[model samples]
Target: MAAPITAALLIIGDEILSGRTKDKNIGYIAEYLTGVGIDLCEVRIVPDVEDEIVAALNSLRQRYTYLFTTGGIGPTHDDITADAVARAFGVGIDHDPRAVAMLRERYQPHELNEARLRMARIPDGADLIENPISKAPGFKIGNVFVMAGVPAIMQSMLDTIAPTLQTGARMLAETIEAEGLAEGNYAAGLADIASAHPGVSIGSYPSFSTSGFRNQIVVRGRDPVAVARAVAAVQDLLHRLKSDGVPH
Candidate 1:
């Protein structure tokens, strides 16, 4: 199998860290990347300070195939993600005519104040990612993609950038519902199975409710045969534990 294409997410906003603005992008981006055969390996939420954003950007962009950032691209004074990105790449940032034109589509000449024009700032040599909703374009420089903080706009930008990404082997997964089985009864056996099938990853998830514990074992891998074999082993383990009178 080819090496997996990996990505890291940098969520930038003082509002998120201060608990004033709840984040809705992390899970959305994670699932999106997974569906498109890109592995999202790490995520970081940083404050709006330019230094903090620049530091996180440099670190993540170097380690992953791509780095995605949401927040701090707005028109407000606190929106410093673009400047941080420019400094991180050692590139100059200025008002790009393309981005300015996009913003013009939404705002009239008189309404395009200095504050609103801040959204038109783009790093040198970056390609603009279109925003159909608000007309403020996100940008891609090197491997770092800067996007809006709003979930809807970020999702739209993701759609625009999807086709440009290089994907890898799609992960295959199987969920074995061990409804009546407790995780403790199967932990050791599952570990053994996981060790036996080196190519597949096995995980146990249990949720509690008024009825009690609902358990599930998920086997995941890039290879279908490997995932299937691991799933069968998990099922057999559950069966044996049931026969041996293990607690529910």
Candidate 2:
């Protein structure tokens, strides 16, 4: 059996909590992790407070194989992700010489102030995650990767660290779309089919249509053969239902 690689996302921004800014990182990272054979199991949105951020970081970092955080590591006063991360790990946060030098090389003296230098403050013994869109880099302490608030910057930083992360066997999914079918009618058969295929994950999607209700079932598994078997099993269930005088 292949080992499971689970991931969690921590969105650190009061804007998301207050509904001022819609959080897009969770969905984006979830898709990315799924593409790379990592399952994203949990996502949390925390405010700018130090205690809350530290507690969330500590909880998620140890619980999952990989923990990803976005937002709050910015030039502004409320950006305290770095400080909170350091506190969570019980390490002191300081401006790395390399990061400082990189910042100095990229920006003029006036642009490099206390606020801007805050970006360079990384937790001790942490590796840096490169930000292609923005010069300010993100850092990885233990399993937690602290990234930027901007979607573009966060995405680019994720790309740099994804290669180093451990991934599970890629899951294969087969989608079956049936028109004008009520999910309630298919429930018993669906349950039986799913029970037969223990390795497969079967999900039923229902939607409203002009003709009637529509149902789409997707069967997913890490093993290709098992996924195919499960799809066949679902098809057999549908065929049996149709044969029993149920209009599908």
Candidate 3:
């Protein structure tokens, strides 16, 4: 079987770090990539500093099949994502005619001031990712994709880039709820099952709510058969634990 395609996300914004702006793009992008057969393997949140963005961009873009960056591409003064992306690739960035034309469709000549024109900048040799909601275009350079921070715009850009991405086998997943069972009780058994099925990934997640505490075991893999086998093993482990009256 072919190896799974992987991607990483770099979320850049001072507002996110400062808790001024809440992030809503990560989950959306993760589901979108998963549905399209690309695994989102890693995610990083960085401040709006140019150096930090450039460093993170360089690191992630090289390590993963694709690197997606969100935030820091707006028209504001702190929107330095484009410049940082150019520096990372050692490429020249300027107001691209294509991006300018796209922006022009939304903004009149008099309204296209210096601040708004900043949205037209594109890195050299990069392809523009279309934005249906807003006129500002995202860009793709090498394996790195730069997009907006706003969830609506980011989702739109993702749709635009989806066709261009090289996808692998779509990952399959199974979820089993071990209600009234604690993760610690199944940790060892889950480790053994994961070891036996090397192709599948097993994870135990515990959640506490106003009603009570519950644990859910999720098994994921590229192969449906492997995932099913892992899920069955997990169920069997849980059944034995329940029968043994193991402490929850």
Summed over model 3, clashes come to: 0
Give the number of the best model, judged by lDDT. 1
For candidate 1, report its TM-score: 0.98
Query: How would the candidate models be sorted by lDDT, starting from the highest?
Result: 1, 3, 2
> Model 3 over residues 1-248: C-alpha lDDT tens digits?
99889999999999999999999988989999999999999999999898899899889998899999999888999999999999999999999999999999999999999999999999999999999888899999999999999998998888888999999999888999997678888888889999999998888888888988878999999888889899999999999999999986
Candidate 2 lDDT score at position 51: 99
TM-score of each: 0.98, 0.94, 0.95
Candidate 3 runs further than 4 Å off:
none
What lDDT score goes with residue 41 in model 2? 91
* For model 2, the run of ten residues with the poorest summed lDDT: 177-186
lDDT of model number 3:
0.92
lDDT of each: 0.93, 0.88, 0.92
Residue-wise lDDT of candidate 1 within 90-179, one digit each (tens)? 999999999999999999999999999999999999999999999999999999999999999999999999999999988888999996
Span of ten consecutive residues with least summed lDDT in model 1: 179-188
> Residue 86 lDDT in model 1?
93
Q: Of the pair 1 and 3, which is ahead by TM-score? A: 1
Cα lDDT for residue 45, candidate 2: 90
